[model samples]
Target: MAESSSTVGKRKCSQDRQVDEKPVPKKGRSLCSTGYGIAFTMHMCNFIVTAQCTVINITMVAMVNSTDHRFQFNDSTEGLSGDSSGGLNNARDTLPAGVPVYNWSPQIQGIIFSSLSYGFIPMLFLSGYLAGRVGTKRVVGVSLFATSLFTIFTPLVTELGLVFFIATRIAQSIVQGSVLGGQHALWEKWGPPHERSRLCSISLSGTILGTFAIILLDGMICQTLEWPFAFYILGGIGCVYCPLWFVLIYDDPISHPWISITEREYIISSLADQIHVSPCKQPLPIKAMLRSLPLWSVCVCGFTHQWLSITQIIYTPTYINSVFNINMRDNGFLSALPFLVAGVTGILGGQLADFLLTKNFRLVTVRKAATFLGNFPSSVLLVVLPYITPSYVTTMTFLILSCGLSSLCQSGIYINVLDIAPRHSSFLMGATRGFAFTAAILAPTVCGFLLNQDPELGWRNVFLLLFAINLSGLITYLIFGEAVIQDWAKERKLTRL
Candidate 1:
């Protein structure tokens, strides 16, 4: 059943009436409202938790050095051993056998680097459900605490053995996964329709920022103090911040004791049709979703976007190494540049999107526009990248441009779940995000295969293939992606999929 214009009009009118009934505060006061505060805290939570995902990768060198023998990464890195400043020796003095160097093969190191991915996926779907059933506050709150605790103890665990270290990383990732999708559920109650895009983008931008921070800083952190200090400093920040999250954030606006009446009324009125004040659980509408072309459009967008994103994130260093002949240290800074730009653009895109809405743009129009703006140009650039060889300035420019623009998708399909089904937004976010992350595994394998086929043409093939995949999503979403709540997604009966 399509939502008729009459129904749409009613929603608009309802929103208007509510605004009339309880006016939002002045612009200055609204900026400081509790909803924004919650979004900020969520951003901070994402910053630290997502950083934990990459801590192992960043500190691998220092960790290897923390073992019994001297760490000689290569003949070229020999200068690193005896530097007067914080080098291997400095770290060694600080952390005496803190991380035992088992005969961990390169394969084991690869697994440890990827162990967080293993744990992150499993908890995505479950966290979405538990956040709604038990409580978002409890789920997110405990997750931070656990993540911080694990991060803080990682050095101790590594001292025990490699197996223990890997296990702790995985366990830490398990809890860290919850905060990813769990936070979306809160938007149903806390975010007004016009405000949702910016709020969600603001919170999610933390992922990009956190990643950049870790990549940029943790290398120095490991070089100066030791690998353990990276985890310690980051984890300590999380530990201190978790209690504040509990104090400041609430599952819903109404439940927040400190919220001004004006803000609470504004949120409740804006979300009246979507929020389920009384909690209930029933079977998910799987059958309904099977018929949802719009849902599939979103899933495709999520997958294709994530596929390309994961590819760039993992292989950018390799690309720079081979194509630009940049040194390893320079590669780290250059590789992180895209995410930093993306984070900045995501926030700016968020504001621009909301501005469009305020100017009376249709929600679908804005979403589709954002999706197109985010994907089409980037895909074109990506497909053409292989043709432009050995131009460091040009290649780096386009690579950064391509990935930076992709962040606009955060305002598109990223928050579309809330638009379509606020009650099930968290679950949908998890399910779709989980579907997207499948690309994380597939991207590496596919890139490896393509590269193995022909060293030169292989890169071209990878680009063309990714472009084609991304194009399919762009086409699908433009045609079929929607922001309307499905009938099955609304208050439901006791029906199984």
Candidate 2:
């Protein structure tokens, strides 16, 4: 009556098949999964792009402050005269005593400072669209490479003519503008819902770090070698980074060859609720997006942040030199100090925001709290800074506190795009950044006009203007911003006949 061995084996195999056919429960998977490759790639991309964009500003300061007649190119000596020593002495005597020998006037200098934003504004939306259509990997990689090529040629272009120099700068800005949009598009596929704030903060903090590193190193390079080396060194770094970026990064977890199956599944499953349809199939809801009040509030907040930050970036060195009586080398390091603090605070603020969300705090509350802490205190400090006397230590302390506090917004308004429209986050970010760059374009001109009126009083007015702008943005966002996903974000269901 005992069953044959072959029959027993067959029966066991059938039972195993039945068990395999049953669906695994989704609840067993973890809610959040952080992928190391995506995070590291994003951080590196942001760091390099930002360094390329800001290095020119530092180089300009060094050029204007240089005592070398060759940098100014004011000498009329023809191709190494027979008496080289006499020619050198002649060039020195031509320079006016107690006056800087730069060829550029203040008006021309202002134009140069604002030119980058001109190209940056128009390319924002296009970058997002291209990223969605093609892939972020190609878009960002090509853009970074093009920007680097232009940066490497900056010194040569400057010698050509003012118009050519401005044109070159504008081209670089256009390419660099794509980086943010491409990053946001990449995040749509890679960033887990719960980990968005932390990832975004870590990546965006690269801007601060880039600024700090460029400013800190530019001074030494200018002093040790020459002003043009600043451009050569930074541009060379960007060129080197491009190859690594293409080799290591992919658009999404599903496509990444090296990612583990466990991590891939976790990312795909977590994103399912947010991205219902393939991004390519989902038509961008331009009408609904334009009408959204929350999106507009985000744009306003971005505008304020960019205006304040850009003004500081362009003018802070001059402000320090004028008020503290420091040389260009010293000014570079001192100016870099505030951004160093901002970069560190940005990471900490992001972690805190993610932690609060994990505790079940409402998204709106967490965002608003971070923004308030970031902008309000910084605004108050800036208002007080102008009133303080010309003590280098005291002024620097206030500047550091102001910039450092403002960094909390990296976790606040900056991360709100992902919450509001996870699928369309790249386009939303592009729109907001475009508006912000508009502010960057105007900030230098406005500061110049104010400074021309009176140095001390005009500078005070600039700080007051920033305070008002920051406070207004804070109030507007607090009233209108919402962190919840809008109904328009959902794909429409079709009824088949």
Number of clashing residue pairs, candidate 2: 0
Query: In terms of lDDT, which candidate is strongest?
Result: 2
Which structure among the candidates has the greatest TM-score? 2
lDDT tens per residue, model 1, 34-69? 888888888889988878766665455445522211
For every candidate structure, what is the RMSD over all alpha carbons to the true structure, in angstroms?
6.9, 10.0
True-structure lDDT of candidate 2:
0.73
In model 2, the worst 10-residue window by lDDT is: 13-22
TM-score to true structure, per model = 0.81, 0.85
Candidate 1 residue runs with Cα over 4 Å from true position: 1-29, 57-113, 155-166, 279-283, 323-329, 448-462, 492-497
In model 2, residue pairs whose N, Cα or C atoms come closer than 3 Å (at least 3 residues apart or on different chains), thus clashing, are none
